[model samples]
Target: MKIFKRTKIKKYSKDGRILFTKEMKKEYTILIPMMLPIHFKFMKNILVKHGYKAELLNTSHSRIIEEGLQNVHNDTCYPALLVIGQLLDAIKSRKYDEDKLALIITQTGGGCRASNYIYLLRKALKKNKLEHIPVISFNLNGMEKNPGFMIRPSLLVQFVYATLYGDILMLLSNQVRPYEINPGETDRIVDKWVIKLSNELNGKSFFSKRNIKRNMEQIAADFAHIPVKKVDKIQVGIVGEIYMKYSPLGKNSLEELLAQEDAEVHIPGLMDFIIYTCDNRITDTKLYGINIIASFLAALLKNYLIRMQNMLIDAVKTQYIFKAPSSFDHIKSLVKGYIGTGVKMGEGWLLTAEMLELINSGIENIICTQPFGCLPNHISGKGMIRKIKERHQNANIVAIDYDSGATKINQENRIKLMLSTARLNLLKAADDSEAFLDNAQTR
Candidate 1:
């Protein structure tokens, strides 16, 4: 028998994982930015099931912002710097294997720095001596390529289940906290439910649309079981660019902090965008009379989503855990009134509409998060707070700007102050209501 000589394999670094060069031998790893918590659970499970080592990086609220200032250009939007800075930190962390990891970022392909963020991240990686790292851009518009990161039908179903479940938990927790008898009870429930749902997401054949509805109902029922007193709770509305409104980093963990302060947060659902996109088609027809069939179909899709929203609202209210339907139109009106319809970034009207809906639904306190250098949000976000306040005097609206150089402590303190005012207002109202009731009963 002839002796075979073995050649040594060369090692390479990707996002932050070990990369093997030989076919069917190299282990692949991917990183998805933490925009939504549910994404982390769903993506990690799917990637692992497919024989890939995937992990999500915990987004840094304080350090990432500071690191962004140190590394990124000062002129870039705060979100851009924070997101890139997060990836940079990940590459340096011991938790991430530097040889075979791939960095992931989402691209909207809009007229904003968000679109250019992917490019900026690449340069930053190169500067940090991570030049060999691969950055994956996740987009519906096909922004980048990584054939290995395919979303199979089964995976997509699970992804949606994860998203909807997370949405429900977020919505329900916000609604329950203000009325809960014990402070932090709602948060406790949320933490518990997230774990439960994460496990449920791992199960096969439980991802049907009907199953999703049942899961939501179960969540509502569980929340209802919580021993909360029926005290009038202060309702706060959060509306801004999609990411800023939903992402912890963008808003500096605004929602969680609000909950801690015993305030109810009403965030407009993502379904609003589907409806708004459809409306654009109808508006186009009215303005130009061009019968674009595709536009009309898009509008139909939005209508379907609106119906879904209505159904969700009905289900929640029928269970009697929170107040009835609150229109998200206030966000739109605020946007239009402040910046006009001319501004459009990832569907400009959507942000505005969400704000308006929250306000109209009787949740007056609002926070609009703006990226420090984001032109559209500046025009549409900061510029409109004053007008929104003027129109609704009770509207306690604050515009917090996120940037690389901005201090997290300062940002949080400012929000803390706003929340303090809300609590005071709520107390004053409760005192007045009790006094009024006493007088009425005596009379």
Candidate 2:
């Protein structure tokens, strides 16, 4: 009888970075940082379906910030601190076996400091004497690689669809939640679809075009049918650093705070950011004569993503009650004169464009959430606010800075002040409408 023996896998790469091998994939649980809760949940499900043990860390304890401050430098951006802290706190919690754990952090591959977060995380791991644990760089631009964690073409497509689904769900639920007659109907619908879609995504026909379209339409219809007492509420749009805008822990539950203040929240979808990143590649080639192949590939990917976005918009349009998201092209066009596309650091001109889109869409009450020490966002976000208001005098924009030192009461108070102005605007508009109706009736 002939027998084959398994060989031991190497633990570290030549560069000294710990490697997550195929053998480890069987036993290790990959912990992902929470960014967009709904989107990440869908993504985590996709990862699980592909035979990987994945867990989304939802722990938002005070120790997370404490851990981040202890390990990461204080001057670094707030998002980085929060993320690193959350991961380290998870490791320290002893909830999972340290030897059987790995981490995944996204790299934008841009000039932004986010690209270096993985290295920072590794350094922190070493400082904490957990250097043996592997960290995976989840990026599109081939920034890093691991045998156990590869994003296959099929997986990438599923991720795209997942974002599309998550965006629509988030958009519809936000619009409905504030107005729904039943307290939690919107959340119930959201929970139901998250499970249903997750199951479908795991199946063989996960990528079926017909099913995707049908599911989107069905989701829109479900939210549309929720009985809402539609009254004029201050429509608030949030645009800022990606993390602060999406992550609840990062923003101190800004969305919930706005809802409590009797405002409807509108946040641009993740796909827009993805598309913006792709568009930046093309922009680089045009302006700086960068690699033609990279630009061409970016253009192709951007077009494909836009096509998917259009399908999502069409699905949302199937229900008239909910306003469909504007096309990314439309958003890009809005920033032509306001900011140059070359300002592609951090959120870049996309931040400026989102504010413009929201203003034009009549969500004039804007909260531009800025993280501490993120210069790019400050430039594109807070810097452009004055220019934006110069054109649209009705624009009510508040730039709130968030960091460990920034108190929630201060942030909420500023938001409250903005809401106060929004309320005055709302009443004035109501009075004007009533007077116009009275004039019409007399005539």
Candidate 3:
């Protein structure tokens, strides 16, 4: 028997010099994936306006998957495959000068396979013989320093609005788009406001305490005006790995798939995950002997995020059927008996808390989607399933494993079976309501 020998990955020299040269700055475009389209639009605009070129890579063709399969291993998580694939495929397309190009990928710098995603991407680029293309890690912690790229305070403020606004838009759009009486009206409104809000977020004056609060209120009001029709539809909450939770590419157009199933989708906003990630830093300080400065920043971010979430909720609840997100403290409280907040890896305690949040909110049908071999999801998701189900007997929960090797049909079939159970429960509840009404009328 002959074992295939794997090529040893070469390490890049750590001389603190950026891979992106100053000469390439004028023409170099950094290619990144689209997790939240609206947020990325705002972010891309900010990056470009600051004398850098940033492009959101999304190809609606089958070649996206083909490129992923060709370069990455079958056992890699779905998002990693698609992201690495999207980058490689775009590079091969030769739309830009190979010499003047770079790629930006987010490294959570947490305890997951994702922290090493850059290494895998480097390997893939090497295999494709595009080794000259620089890869940058877009993280707040300065994991990989690049002289060509830096996060300034002004840009950070814009990103704050980008995230808060994106969260507001995402939260409202999910509710509006599915039920809007006028086809495409929801999307039209969302697009219109994203541009309007992006413009409002540009100036220093825009970030003042008064203006930020006003903008959050106004953004909520704008989404509330999207003429939505009240309809009885099965509301399904999608909670899982951060990427799979929101990214269409990662989850195979899951929101659309639910729409086809006549289900109203409820995705916890990206802000929740962002807050969870930030909150983990504070938790990390408690866990290990992490620095006090890191703890202070994390706490500051956690507070700001909580306030922003509440502001959107208050403004939107006046007109729409919007449910404000739970506070970080509340989410942490959720996992006390079932799991610990200490289980902070991958989606960690946040995944369990999200499921519990959805269950409590009457959106009992849930799909906990995770990539195969994702240990954190395995522990926090499937591991806590029994505990969650024991508490909520009517919870129609399904955990779907997404891997490169998993077929769409097979994955969908499992979802269908879960939905079938959900439909039955819905019918039973309707019957019970009708029976009670009939009995009262007879009396």
Best by TM-score: 2
The best candidate in terms of lDDT: 2
Q: Name the runs in model 2 displaced over 4 angstroms.
A: 1-10
Clashing pairs for predicted structure model 2, backbone only: none
Of candidates 2 and 1, the better by lDDT? 2
Residue 367 Cα positional deviation in candidate 2, in Å, after optimal superposition: 0.4
Candidate 3, residues 291-364, lDDT tens digits: the string is 67988988997898788777766766666467666666776787778887888889899899999989988889
Q: Per-residue lDDT tens digits of candidate 1, residues 273-338?
A: 545655666666766787588557756655655655555565566577465444334345555545
In the range 399-436, model 2's lDDT, one tens digit per residue, is 99999999999999999999999999999999999999
Supply the TM-score for candidate 3: 0.92
Off by over 4 Å in 1: 1-26, 46-52, 59-62, 152-154, 178-205, 229-233, 273-311, 324-342, 435-439
Worst 10 residues of 1 by lDDT: 1-10
Better of 2 and 3 by TM-score: 2
- CA lDDT, every prediction? 0.66, 0.92, 0.79
TM per candidate comes to: 0.81, 0.97, 0.92
